[model samples]
Target: MNDDGRRTTRMRDRAAGAAVMEQVVRLHAQAPPRSTLARALGARPIGEDTAPWFAGALGEREVGAVLDRLPEGWSVFHAIPVGTRPDASGAVSDVDHIVVGPAGVFVVNTKHHRGQRVWVGERAVLVAGQKQPYLRNSDLEASRVRGVLAQAGIAAPVTGVVALVGTKEVTVRQQPRRVLVLRAEQLVRWLTRRPAVLDAATIADVARLFDDPATWRPVDSSADTVERFAVIEREVRTAQLVRAGWMLAVALGAVAVALPVVSVLTR
Candidate 1:
């Protein structure tokens, strides 16, 4: 999502294959399809190898779609850049999404871990069996945004959120000290149900501050799409391999069980 209130457009683009799709499209447009060039660039058969990236992009999009459904008073910003400027490399680092409205300002961090169990503690989070700093990172993101807005004379309360997308189970062992963890579907409900703490005028004011590039740092719009694509490709490949390994393990366990059963039946 670009910083110009084009969340829906961005989401639509991402869901339609995004950068990888763009690469493929460009290659096809060539006089003779540049199969070699595309392959060299890590474009595979485009099934499992690319599913993860598309899935993740779609996850953010799903949340964005939900945000789109909010009432007129709400202002949703997707792909927000917070804290520092596009780093030493001149690329924009993004906060997944943000919602500003009567309820207050919410820093929405979307996680796309399909079928994994999520455990939330007062200070940490665990996805499947791996420790993730989702809450801590989200808290820092929210704080950074708060600081930026405060300087603009808008001191609206900013809350951090970790919205799990397609997760199998979510257990809140204890509420995190700073961030609220919930499923993506529940996100909109929770936000809409919050007690109103800001008025329409203040919400509009806060939205204006975020819309200004000065609130964030120098934004490097160039090459951001390419960089994002590269990252997505890597994640897709990794997710494919992980799923393959899990399938292999499950198949081997099934074979092992069947072996003993077959032996007993023969006797």
Candidate 2:
């Protein structure tokens, strides 16, 4: 609702992982039966179906946290539902994060490759020696954002960014022609350093357009989505801690037995 008493749907301000979080929640609900014994032994309760989305949700949250610290004059929107997928299934695709500031608009694609090596070349991205289509995908995402703004009678420069999270190494052989690649931790600094490209009024106008839900595809989100995810995340973390404790106990017990045997043999 608005001051005009007209119905309205404003985009969620803190929708960093809303898309992936929905996938995680849905897949978790549909996961096949798991062994109760394995769960008791501290195995992760989430099956393979939901594991990737869970990780993705965490990655977006991390990147969102970094973006949240952006200085004044910058605005960011996350998990923006965009155009439909090319597969013709009518499935909507989403942009991980959209940032509007004095510098320019940025369409950020977040890749969460925890502890993996990432190498970016002029035309390709390799994660742990496996080639990925991140470069091509980012370019298309930026183009879509530009089209959306143009439709709103706004002309702006939109840049594509691939924000890698928790990677062991990010070696850029060469910068991509269309997209910027960097570690998530460096995103805010890089963005802020760019020269001012839009004035305050223009920035506000662009942000207002972005804030309107009609600018993007429709998304189904609940107010309690973040809360539900927090519950699941806590469960996963507790299981990991329990597993680590058991491993430590086993190692210590083996060492304790080995010490007496070693002492007897030495005597």
Off by over 4 Å in 2: 1-9, 32-36, 85-91
Q: Name every residue pair that clashes in candidate 2.
A: none
**Model 1 poorest ten-residue lDDT run:** 8-17
Cα TM-score per model = 0.66, 0.92
lDDT of 1 by residue, 70-162 (tens): 877888777665545444423345677878988999988888898899998898899987899897789989988888787888769999998
How good is model 1 by TM-score?
0.66
Give Cα-based local distance difference scores for all models. 0.70, 0.87
Highest TM-score against the true fold, candidate: 2
lDDT per residue as tens, model 2, 1-267: 445554445664647988788777766767665477776678897987678889999999999999999998999999888865533322358899999999999999999999999999999999999999999999999999899889889878999999999999999999999999999999999999999999998898899998887777655546677887888898799789879988999999999999999999999
RMSD of each: 8.2, 3.1
